[model samples]
Target: MAEPILTVKNLSKSYGEQQVLHDINFSLQKGEVMTMLGPSGIGKSTLLRCLNGLEDFQTGELVFEGQTVKADNANWQQLRQKIGMVFQSYDLFPNMTVLQNITLAPVKVQKKSKAEAEQAARQLLKRVQLSDYANSYPRELSGGQKQRIAIARALAMHPDLMLFDEVTASLDPEMVRSVLDLIKELSEQDNMTMIIVTHEMNFARQIADQVLFLDQGTILEQTAGKDFFTNPQTQRAKDFLASMDF
Candidate 1:
């Protein structure tokens, strides 16, 4: 399938002597969305962090864009440029304006001209429905608006893969849908390649092309999105679905 944009083979991780992930294996094709779903503290977030190099894995390998990636390898920094990650926290620089936040990476790391970066930043702001907030500070925006700007900052880098770690988890109930809608649009309209870790089950069923149902650091089921919610193959998955309010 076009050589799979990202592949994780026998991937595992641990904190001190306690293992958190056990032989996790999956592959994501270009423009596909894979949602990592499980109960709290089940290593879903850790796996996502490993993929983006925010955390290190103790064993196995990640292949991105046809190259095998090791956590400490020199190629990792270069590969990170193509992998955009948005966290639960809105990590915008408080000192920088929204426009400045989006433009900084492109200008500094990408070596783009300031005017070019600003233009791209403005376009991203428009896409996220925050064009008017370009000159505003992070402190002035609502949680949702700040999150959108964080997403725009990632997009300004022009990533090939997007990693979202419960981006809506920290938002107010009223603000959740807008952020989720934006992500859904990226999947439906822009055809973005993404690996998402989310507790929003309904959104997971709607947006996923594949679902990895994990439990206690291991995958209990990896199935197509449509079949998973309707007819889960594993008992763990069925119990998980049954327990959720949705």
Candidate 2:
């Protein structure tokens, strides 16, 4: 395998006296879709935050493309440009039209020309099947549409990697599948490395190349999606899969 695009070693984090993650180690190669599966409150989101430099870690190393990420790392903004994230909540600008929201960051931060940004944003919206809703405000769109626009906004940055933290967790049941389908398409079409933290085990089984089973802030098992789901080696993973009835 090639050298990993993201390398995390002995990554640990805490809140005051409580440690949320402990000695976490993982590496993600370019174009790999790695899913982290765990119960709630297991520090899955915390780990993702640390990976993208959102949360500060007191110990260990997070390296993106060979550059180490630390609490006071000065290159964060530069690094973050290549790593995009989408959250469970659709954090759209309520006042901006969908197209504006999608192009805002690229135009303002990346210095993309308005015409260029609009062209790219429109293409992304089309990819997410929301080309018709460009003029709609966030409030005017359904939960799924808002999420797709959020994804389009992320892609507008032209990131090399994407981190999705339960991106569909806030959507209605009917809307969830639409967003998932879009993500599934991303896994098929984009070469972007992805670290997805989600409870959607069925989607994980289908889209993930590798699965990491996390428990109590530790990675219990790391295996390919097929082997991990079909024949999990750890008792914790087996228990988790049993509880989910997978």
Candidate 3:
């Protein structure tokens, strides 16, 4: 059997005196898609942030491609190269053009030459269907366009795993489909490994290879996608699907 590319063991996180995540455990093999579904204010977003090292945990560890990094002594800089994360806020540099924003990491962090990075960035832009927007600034594009550029920017790094934290949460309803469709394509065509936190039930149903249903900082159910949406194992999961009108 092929080994999982990522694994989290007894991952617990807290804020000051309050705990938000408790003993979280899961694994993701290469080219698999796992969607995290939960009620708002649950630990979903926080968990994603922890995985990307935006927030450090007091306990537990993450193993990526066989290297174990304990939360207490983590240096995610190296791991960041292989793990791409996209936030709902479209955290692009407002001053830089789309091309520059997409190529910055490749050039600075990866130490690729300008010409090489730009060439690869252009290809990513085309892949994201925003080739025409390459020279435009982030301020000029619509929400969906900016999100696409964000995805392009992440892909320019050729990450082995992608983490999306409600990338469509801030978009207008009409613009949400475009971004979601792009993500679906990344799974189907590029075969990217991903962990997505989303509220779009139908999209999750279509794209998730597996489902992680979180509630009150704990995993209520971790089941196959079809089983999760259709025959949720736990009452909390069933109630969650009901609330989403799935």
Candidate 4:
């Protein structure tokens, strides 16, 4: 097997005296999609945040591309460039147009030229099927369009791994499929490495190469996507699936 693109070993986190995550371990290979499934407050979102350095872990280690991630390390900024994350909220700058929003990070953080950034932004917009909305403001677009723009902004950085935190949770029911479809397309066509924290079981089963069942911070089961859904090995996982059905 090839070396994993990302590895988490004995990972744990806490908020004050309350421990939120326990000794979590997993690895993600290049071009693989892993979906985290769990009930609310299971620390799924927190795990994704920790992976991209948005949250600090109190113990364990995160090895990305073979280098350890240190919260206080000066290279954090550079390391973050390789990990792009999208949140449930669109997080778009309302003051900026779609094109400007997509190009901002590349121009400022990456120091790419305005023309270069804009060119990349346009191509990303087309990929997300929002090329016609380049000049539109966030307020002028639908929930799905805004989310797609946010995704394009993340892709503008050309990240090696993408983390999605319940990205469809905030969208309207009608809009959810479009965004999910876009992500599925990216995984299939671009072979993007992704860690998605989602409650959409069917969608997860469709795109994920692996499925991780998390409960109260610990990983209860980690297995191939199909097997995890069809033949869950743990009672906790079985109960979760049963609850989702009922």
Candidate 5:
């Protein structure tokens, strides 16, 4: 097997007196999709945030795409530029047009010229199948369309890895397919490593290469996706599979 693109060791986090994650360790290879499966309030999102450096982790070493994510200024900025995250809620700028939303970070953070950023943004929107909605405001788009734009914005950063925190959770049933399809496509076509925290078991089965089952802030099972779904080793994972009717 190839060396992992992201290495998470002894990852632990807590909120006040309650611990949300406990010594979480996992490595994600380039071009792989690993889904974090767990019930609500099990710290799935919190783990993703820590992996992406969006939240401070108490004690852990996150080596993302060859660089360590730390409080050091240089490493933090480099790690961030290579990692992108998409939220359950689209989190698009309501006042900005889709194109503007997608181009903002590239132009501001990457310091690309407006023309260069817009060109990259347009291409990304096309990839997400939202090219026609570029000029539209977030309010003017449907929930699914707005999410697609959010995805496009993330892609505009040319991230080597992406953390998706229930990206389809807020969408209507009919709208969920579009976002999932785009993600599936990316997993297939790019050398992008993705860590997704989601409740969509079927989607996880279909798109993820591996699955990590979390329970009470610990990993109960970690295995190949198909094997984990069909024949989980841990009782907790079996119960989760049964609950999902898989």
Candidate 6:
């Protein structure tokens, strides 16, 4: 078996006195897609945020590639460069054009020249089927288009792993499929490694190699995607699937 590209052990998190995550553990291989499924406020998004360094955990370990991730010791900026994230909100800069939004990180953080960054941004926009929207501001685009641009912006950094926190939740019913389709295409064609938190069960079943069922911040079950849907081992998982009408 190939070595995991990322690993988590005994991961836990808390907000003040309230604990939100407990002993969460999982791993991801290169080019693999893992879907996190659970009920609302179950720490699915919190787990993603922890992995991407947006939130600090109280305990546990994160190993990316071969190095241990320490909240205090790790170079967060460098880690973030390797781990890109997209949120439920498009979070695009309203003042910047799509191209500008896409090119910003590469230019400022990666120190790429404006010409180089713009060139790469254009190619990424083309990949997301938003080439013509390059000069368009965020307000001019639909939810789907803006989300795609946000994806392109993340891709512009050429991250090794992508964290998606309920990325499709804000989209309209019609727009959800387009964003999900684009994500599926990226996983297959670009061999991107991703951890996604989503309520889209059908999409998760179709695209994920592994499914993690989280409940009240604890991982109730971890199994192959098909197995998770067909034969959930835990009652919580079963209940979750039943609730989703799966």
Taken over the whole model, the C-alpha lDDT of each candidate is 0.92, 0.88, 0.91, 0.92, 0.87, 0.91
Tens-place lDDT digits, model 6, residues 1-246? 788999999998899999999998889899999999989988898889888888899899999998998686358788998999999998999999999999999999999999999999989988889899899999999999999999999999999999988999999999998899999998999999999999999999999899998889898889975789989999888888999984
Tell me how candidate 2 scores on lDDT: 0.88
Native-to-model Cα distance after best TM-score fit, residue 82 in candidate 2, in Å? 0.5
lDDT per residue (tens digit) for residues 48-110 in model 2: 988778899888997888777655656777777899999998899998999999889898988
- Model 6 off-target regions past 4 Å? none
Candidate 3: global Cα-lDDT? 0.91
> Would you give me the overall lDDT of model 5?
0.87
Error of 2 at 41 (Å): 0.9
- Tens digits of per-residue lDDT, candidate 1, 125-234, equal 99999999989999999999988899889989999999999999999999999899999999999899999999899999999999999999999999976788999988
C-alpha positional error of residue 214 in candidate 4 after TM-score superposition, expressed in Å: 0.5
TM-score of each: 0.97, 0.96, 0.97, 0.97, 0.96, 0.97
lDDT of 1 at 91: 94
Model 4 agreement with the true structure over 1-246: per-residue lDDT tens digits: 999999999999999999999999999999999999999888999999999888899999989998877777567788878899999998899999999999998999999999999998999988999999999999999998888899999999999999999999989999999999999998999999999999888899899899999999999999975788889999999999989882
Relative to the true structure, candidate 3 reaches a TM of 0.97
What CA root-mean-square deviation does each model show from the true structure? 1.0, 1.2, 1.3, 1.1, 1.4, 1.1
Clashes of each: 0, 0, 0, 0, 0, 0
